[model samples]
Target: MLINDLIILQRGADLTKIAEFKLNSFNSFFINFIALLIFSLGFALILSITGIEPWLAYIETTIYNGQILGLFATLLGVVILHELLHGLAYIIFGAKLKFGIKYLNIYTMDISGTFYTTFEMVVILLFPIFVLTGLLLISGILFPGLIYWMIIAILYNISGSFGDIFMLIIILFMGKNCKIKDEEYGFSIYT
Candidate 1:
C-alpha cells in the first residue's frame, strides 16, 4: 500500500519505470552468503599478506572472559549504526529519510521528492560499508586486542549489505538521473 502510494505520487509525465526487484528470503540469503564468502576470502588474503594471523588474535581474545555478551552487544550496535549511516547519507544528499524494521530486518530509506545522480545514489548505498569497514580496519590495526571483534563486525556488516550492493549494481546501469523510491522490502527505480 505504501509503495503504491509512493508510485502514484512520484509518477511524472516523463518518468518511466526502468526496473524493480524485491528482496525475498531466498535471494537475500543467497546474495548475503556469496557476499560473506567473498569478504571473508578477501579479509583472509589481507591478513595473509600482512602476516597477521587471525587465529592468534582469536586465541588472545579468548583468554579474556565474558566477551560473548560484549560481542553480541557490539554486533547489535553495529546494525543500528549501519542503518543510521544510510539515513545520514540520504540526508546529506537532500533526500527525505525514513527508517523501519520488519521482523529481523532493518531498513533505512529516502522516502520521496528527491532524485539522485548515479554517483550520489551509489555513495548513499555504499556509504555504510565504506565507513564501517574503514573504521573496523583502523581500530583493529591500532588496537590489536580488538581485532577479533572488529573482524566479526566487519564480516557481519558486509554480509548485511547484500541488498544495498544489489541495488547499487542495478542503479549503476540505469540512466544518470534516475530516482528511487525505497520500500521496506525493496526499491523501485524510475528514469
Candidate 2:
C-alpha cells in the first residue's frame, strides 16, 4: 500500500467544460463548513424521529472502555472506508478510478474524466453516506455496547461528506447529459 502526504488527482481538461467547482475556493469552503452543521442537525432529527437508538444511549456509555481512543480510530477507519465505498460505486458503474488525498483525506477520481453519467455520479456520491450510515446503525443496534461510538461515527462520516453532498446538489440540476470528473480539490462538469 502506498501513501503520500498529498495526492494530485487533477488533470488537464480534455473535454468540453461547462463549469468547474473547486473545494479550496472561498465560497465552496464556506458552503462545505455550513453543510457539515446542516448534516449534523438533519441526521440528528432523523434519529430522533426514528428512535432507532435512544439519544441517551449515545451519551451515557459505561459499557465500553477506551472510548476516546476507540472513537478516533473508528472515525479514521470510517473516512477511509467512505472513500473506498465511493471507489466501489465508481467501479460498479464502469469507471476507472484513482485514489488520492487532496489535503489529508481520500477522494476518488474517474481517471478518464468523462466516464460517469449524471445519475451514476449521484449514486457514487450518495452511496457511502447511505451504506455506511445503515451499517453503523445495524451494528449499533446489534451490539448495544458499541452504540455510543457507532452513532458518533455515523454522524462524523455523514458530516464529513460535505464535498460529495455539495457536488451532488450541483450535479442534480446538471441533467444526465453531462459527464463528471473528480478532481483533487473538487469536480469538473463536462457537456
Candidate 3:
C-alpha cells in the first residue's frame, strides 16, 4: 500500500515526505545480518556477566519430536504480533495507524501529522524489541522446555528490527521536533 492509501484511511493531517531511505533486498539482508550479530554478541555478553556458559546454551540444539508444525505456527504468530506492537506504539503516541505487507514482509506505519520528539520516536521504534524480548526471557525462565523457542523468538525479532534501529540512529542525529511518516520499506523525517 502507498502512503496516499494511508492518508485516505486515516483522514487526518497531511504529511510531507522530507527524507526517505529505501531498502532493497541486498541492503536489507546486510542490515539484518549486522543486527543479528550485534544482538547475539550482546546477549552472549549478558549471559557471561551473569555467570552463564554462553557457548554451551548457544551451541545446544533441540530436536523437535512432533512440534515442528506447532513451532512454525508460533513463529508466524510472533511475527504478526511484532508488527502489531509497532502499530500499538504509534497509536499510543497519538498517531494514526496503517498496516501493510510488501514483498512478503509486514510493516506498520504511523501516518499522522504529529511531529514527535526524538525520545518519543526512539521509544516507538524500540518498543517491540523491549516488550517481545522481555516476554520471551520471562517465559524461558519460567518454563525450561520453552527456552529454545524463547531464544529463537528474541533473536528473530531483534534481527528483524534492523530497519527500525537504523532509522532510530538517523533520527537521533536530526533536530528535535521532527515529524516522521513511516512507510513499508522506510520512513521520512521532516524538520
Q: Among all windows of ten consecutive residues in candidate 2, which has the lowest summed lDDT?
A: 1-10
Candidate ranking (lDDT, best to worst): 1, 2, 3
Best by TM-score: 1
Off by over 4 Å in 2: 1-15, 25-28, 39-65
Tens digits of per-residue lDDT for model 2 on 81-191?
898999899889766778876444467777644446788887999999999999999999999988767877888877877778777888777767887777657787876
Q: What is the lDDT of residue 49 in candidate 3?
A: 70
lDDT of 1 by residue, 9-45 (tens): 6564457778876767776677767877877886787
- Cα lDDT tens digits for candidate 3, 27-63: 6677767877977886776576755654355344333
Error of 2 at 90 (Å): 0.9
TM-score of each: 0.76, 0.74, 0.71
Top-down TM-score ranking? 1, 2, 3
Question: CA RMSD for every model?
Answer: 4.3, 6.5, 5.3
Report the number of the highest-lDDT candidate.
Answer: 1
Candidate scoring better on lDDT of 1 and 3? 1
